[model samples]
Target: MVKNSGEGISKSVLYLMSAGAGLVVANNYYNQPLLNLIATDFGVSESAVSNLPLLTQLGYAFGLLFIIPLGDKYPRKKMVMIDFVFIIASLLIMALAPNLLVLIISGFFVGFSCVVPQVFVPMAAQLAKPEKRGRAIGVVMSGLLIGILGSRFISGFIGEYFGWRSMYFIAAGIMLIFWVLLKLKLPELQPDFKGSYKALMQSLWGYFKSEPSVRLAAVRGGLGFAGFSAFWTTLVFLMEDNFNYGSGVAGTFGVLGIGGALAASYVGKLSDKMNKNKLITIATLVMLVAWCVFEFSGHSIIGLVIGVILVDMALQSLHISNQNIIFSKNPDARNRINTIYMVGYFIGGAIGTTTGAYAWQIFHWQGVASLGVFYTILILIFHLVFKKSLA
Candidate 1:
């Protein structure tokens, strides 16, 4: 990646980061639309199969806690490439998994190693101009948004046509392409922190304790992500139960999300001028509406389509805006700050996956909608009540 001292990072690198972020972050989401197909293959119940995403989120959260701080201490290009290899290995294992339990165990490693995009995001913040930091993070995060949405579209499509296992095989190949590209194009960056791993982890705890804004952003973002995860995790189940739709149709719904979700960069740029907390409040409200729409959707594809767009946009708005808040607070500590925020964010995701599965089992879509509503209200409270102008 090239950076002009007065200008900032090159356009090529921005594109690379954007695309790469989408592809890498996608590893965590590939199982959503294929949950039913996967469940059928393993002869398991939906609740049991749900462990795939749940454990993956937990793995991602653990990695965010234990590994992401290293972005601040190691040469990042080297670190990111290393993560890619680990992700590839995990994907291959899942593709060839001998049993549901084996696949679920590998899903955890997949989430653990899929932290590459987290590395890219803070790097974008570090390389961009002070005023443009939000835009840069947004650009990278937009790729993440696409990856989050697109992964489902692709995996659902692939799983329908080529078996669920083929999706993992394809995912591994795509990751390989990114690894080679970044190895050649992405630049090596000097580390900001000079501490032992133990010291680094301890420092993060201190930062989390001392930084109230980081706590707000993490909790608020996490809650919104929980809602986001809850909906997506159970979408395939809904389609199957209500419409007899398979992964292909369920995945096609992901395309609906891509349009409004692309607003991440715009939301990011807006954070530069607006109060980020307020944007978060608005996003949470929208998410609440999205769930209301979802609960009433019943068998209507139109309702699902509308709900997907709203939820994706709201999550993107909440996410990029939150990034704008925390990343702007301290440039040097960007990676450490991100670790604190993302750990909470993914933990929320895991909880949502678990809750959504439970609700879908006992109370079906209505239960999932109620759970989503609960998360959105919590997010709203975190932003509105604890509103502070940190950035």
Candidate 2:
């Protein structure tokens, strides 16, 4: 039987959360492969279309900062269901958008609603038995990882065949189906904090001010991610420009990059068993190598494949590892802590997307690869200074 608050979650509900989180989060990524199509339809330059992803990520950052804390003050199930309503509307707007302005505005809402998956993550944590919490979170994470890895590939093929709008249409339909499923399957969860919105916001700032570890980890992970985001933002453009390949070919790289994402989960486990400083240090050094490969050899497919794997593995390592550090600091404050860290994270993504597009417009692959190396170098500098916390 399905359990209520703090009791064990049913296997079916757990699977639903996993699938729901995956599909919902995938909404954030579907645009990457479709950027080429978006550019073509709008008759805009690569730099212009880049704003779509950039704005979406910025929107996600804003939502993380602002909306996440509400879960602490209110029932989660109702909040998620409400978020889905907005997501559906946004996806529909995107599917039928008449102008770039409309698409960009709606894209932001999509990212904002994309925060729903994050809500599911914490919900899974609360519902599973203490002994099984890790496994539960891992199951959900696996779903998330698969959704991320598969979205590009799925969207690429769909966008190539049925028109880019169809992808959004299909995504909207899936969200609608899940919306109904969740309403039926999910039990209402109680609020963890009884604080007002003002106090919640204040506490987040307090953590940022007081936690040296949060600061270090957020900075290290954010800037490091900016570089990798640049690569992803520019990858489709690269495929089209250099190899005369389409979105489908460009997206297969997502599949190839799965190794890196998997490597991140491994590093997350190691955070408990290994020294944080040593673990991150090695990951940083590995990131440098990935960027160097991109700079020198990214023109070739084999080189591109290798660089993608290495960079993803390295970037995701920083994410999972840094996240572990923050979560360890104060259990009661995890929601707020996650809010601050993710805000910085997605903000970095927005900047990287902008940088990638602008770089591609001018110097092409060399510029993209060079800036990536530069970002990795900056991460290394920051890590050395912040490595104390990792110890």
Candidate 3:
């Protein structure tokens, strides 16, 4: 795990990695803002729209268990390149889907293949010095977070202007360009584990048991992400129903939060210098406050926009801090830890999306805000109970 800071990452290499991560990871989010459009187009119920997030998340969970483990046994750069080709094809399938069932199937492939960034995050960590690993991961992850947020706006705009199908075309094009760039710029990294798939899967439990902090950090991240997603999963509905806004107006909110999402680089640097426990504690506090802001911002678009920025800042900052801590624990095994960590995070996210939608159906925006607040408190309690172990 020895790093070479003196060599430093070149701009071309960094762009190759970031762009690859962005385009690949964007697949996870393209469905977010498009849920309403998809639901209407397919003649499905609003409740059914919830399944897209749930199924996509299940796909991500499946990938962490099945697909991502290959990073430990195969050549990652080639794996990523091959996966991008599949991502492009998958988006085409999603765009051309004839029914809701077809779209759900497309969502699965999108989630499964979008894990290329999971490979890149650890790879970036492996490439940097111990002191700079957090910063490296942050920079790469900022690309990822940006893709998640920006794609919402982009997809919404494309869907609004040209058509929802155009959203997929743009995504495919981005992935195609990313494929060419990565193949040209990214250096090969051989996998550390050369065992059979069964052996690799079995070893996951052993790795989990051996790293307590990684486990705590993973759970903490899972809960945090769940709360973070709960607000967003049902946001478009709230916008349309409560605020009386169109998809385009609602999507513009994504741009408002980009500043917070882009600050991960600074947060990563701070994580490198600050006490990990203190950083996480502060982040949770911010999230708690953000949820309260959201709860009180009911019926006001400007108020909700302000809350989104604060919540985005809190969530992204905590994400950077959590990643900094967990990835710091095991360098060679980062891919496995991330696989474990992100699986938990996305499972929580899946649950959030499902539960958030139901909460909205039952109690509307109040229910959605309540879910965020409830999870935020739950995470705080868990962090407190596990404080000794986490430390």
Candidate 4:
């Protein structure tokens, strides 16, 4: 049962909160479809335009490190509202950017501010009972997955039809509305960590050092995310160059991943009854196989569709599994544990994105596929070493 409030979650409220959180998180990803447009507008090389994704992912890592821990020390609702405002500002900046550097900078702030979903997920898990926590998290995560997958198409359409800059204007308006809903509907909670900022930062490090499961999950998710990102970061280029498709066609690939995102809702239900370590191992193996499929199918549309579905499913499943493990560790420290795991995950993503971009520039789709496989191998190796230990 849902625990903290002694009442079941109102379905409407739950869905709204989840959707709001998902929209906030989507800010981190909308640039993928816009990269080519931005390159053309700024007269920058593809690799230079690649900085948008690379730096945005990096900004997420930075926020996960510095901002997420604040969840434990402040009122979450206020923090979320504040974050929404920052997102609006950042989106506005991106919409009006005069140069590549300005757009990159705005993308960074947008990413940094988008970590609100991390806070929201943990808060949802915390409010629910241990038994319901997985499902609650699953519900919230479903929204996140939808936003991630949907933004590709929706944002791509907005960018293609109106211009890439117009997409940000729409996002900014949505964020403003979301802020009002958050302010009106969310409950207030007291701080869990009462220490000063410096002390809290130190304690965060302590938690990472002391928690075996957190470290294991972080490494596991980090590797998995790296592999997941490698394929996606370079996918647009492959679709455009090899298939002679535009961003619109590239965005349609998002549909392939929706099944996986929907499956994430069930993953938590599975986690409630299954051996999480085994599940994670299975997910990692699937990820490796998915990358192999992607590498082999880079030239075939049907092959690409199959590979995308498998890869997205594997990635989302592993993501849910990792969260199930980490959040179960300490309810009070959920924010910090998430901060650590996400920091690792996004850093891995940033590295993967950067490497994929340059590799795409030099070695083309083959290079991108190779990087995905390499990261998948790293994830598999990490699982092999720690699966027993995690168990």
TM-scores for every candidate against the unseen true structure:
0.97, 0.92, 0.96, 0.96
**What number of clashing residue pairs does each candidate have, in the order they appear?**
1, 0, 0, 0
Least well predicted 10-residue stretch by lDDT in candidate 4: 1-10
Between candidates 1 and 2, the lDDT winner: 1
Candidate 4, residues 165-193: lDDT per residue as tens digits? Answer: 88888899989988888888887667778
- Using TM-score as the yardstick, the better of models 1 and 3 is 1
Candidate no. 2 TM-score: 0.92
Q: Give the whole-model CA lDDT for all candidates, comma-separated.
A: 0.87, 0.80, 0.80, 0.82
Where does model 3 exceed 4 Å of error? 1-8
Task: Score candidate 3 by TM-score against the native.
Answer: 0.96
Best TM-score among the predictions, by candidate number: 1
Error (Å) of candidate 4 at residue 335 is 0.5
Which number leads on lDDT?
1
Ranking by TM-score: 1, 4, 3, 2
lDDT of 4: 0.82
Candidate 4 lands at a TM-score of: 0.96
